[model samples]
Target: MQPVVHLAVGYLCYAAYTRLHHGREPADLPALVAVFAAGLADLIDKPLDAAGVVPVGRTIGHSLLFVIPLVLLVWIVASRRDRRLLGVAFAIGYLSHVATDIPWHVFSGDFDELGFLLWPVTEMPAYTGVKPLGTVAGIEITTLWLEAVILVAAVACWWMDGRPGVGLFRPSHRA
Candidate 1:
């Protein structure tokens, strides 16, 4: 999926969540921002793909290094009310990027000696093969899909939060 798609999906989904939880009102400004930004990150995959830095359908984007710290930082800075939702949204949106890229390629369990590079999905075991990019099982792997979902999600967040805006940039949401 693309950023536009992710944003749209995220917005619709977030809207549903807002309606269910806090009525038609907004959720949180920061949460929306984080989710939106996370969706934006999906764009990076294109360059990586064209460059062949990693296999198209591999564990390239499935990393906790960045999102984990981001969540922790937001939690530390934000108030109690905002921290939980904000962190969760950001993580989900970020991972949404990974979810979108599942169907594009086949996941082989073949990895390098260090187990970092899993190129040969065919040789790998049963669990080794994974849908690298797509909405399958709610995991993202493509920039387009994640970005599209997050973009929509951010809009929903803005609608729900209804307050001093977090920022003017509402890209997409995912994960």
Candidate 2:
């Protein structure tokens, strides 16, 4: 559940950041910026997670209402089209995370060890005990996995976007 949620959010954030701020072409600033924003969101998660029911790291923070309105505000204030795209994609991707993550985890396996994905209806991870660690752990399983996922997604996006001279998170290479 944590894996799916964060991975999707990270990829979406990267997509939004890359498309919106960095330009549909390529740039590193937005990727790093989104990572920073996600980190900040994680920090906010510490105080916002409410038994993962009302909302948690991937629920509210990753929610469309939260991420979209936020990006819209930035788009309005900064007049950044790229950032706006990122915001939109970020919102969609984040929500998609929940859509794919929660329901699947909730109904996937035995979930005896992890079932908070259902929330309200069923709880097995003991709330705080399964309260996601990647955002906080930084290099732990959740973070590492999400990092890889987002990296792959971003690179794939760049490739598919038809931009040239870019390898991945790195700058363009004409050589």
Query: What's the residue-level lDDT of 114 in candidate 1?
Result: 17
Q: Kindly report which residue stretches of model 2 are placed more than 4 angstroms away from their true locations once superposed.
A: 1-9, 12-25, 37-41, 48-65, 80-103, 109-175
Best by lDDT: 1
C-alpha TM-scores of all predictions: 0.45, 0.39
**What is the C-alpha lDDT profile of model 1 across 11-48, one tens digit per residue?**
44544555677676445563465347446545554456
| Each candidate structure's count of clashing pairs | 56, 3
Q: Give per-residue CA lDDT, model 2, range 1-175, as digits (tens).
A: 4443354455555565556665664344444344345444344444556555444343345344455666566556544554554444444444444344443334334354333334334443433323233344454343345445655775676567553233345666686
Scored against the true structure, residue 63 in model 2 reaches a CA lDDT of 44
Where does candidate 2 have its weakest 10-residue lDDT segment?
Answer: 126-135
- 105 Cα displacement, candidate 1 (Å): 7.9
TM-score of 1: 0.45
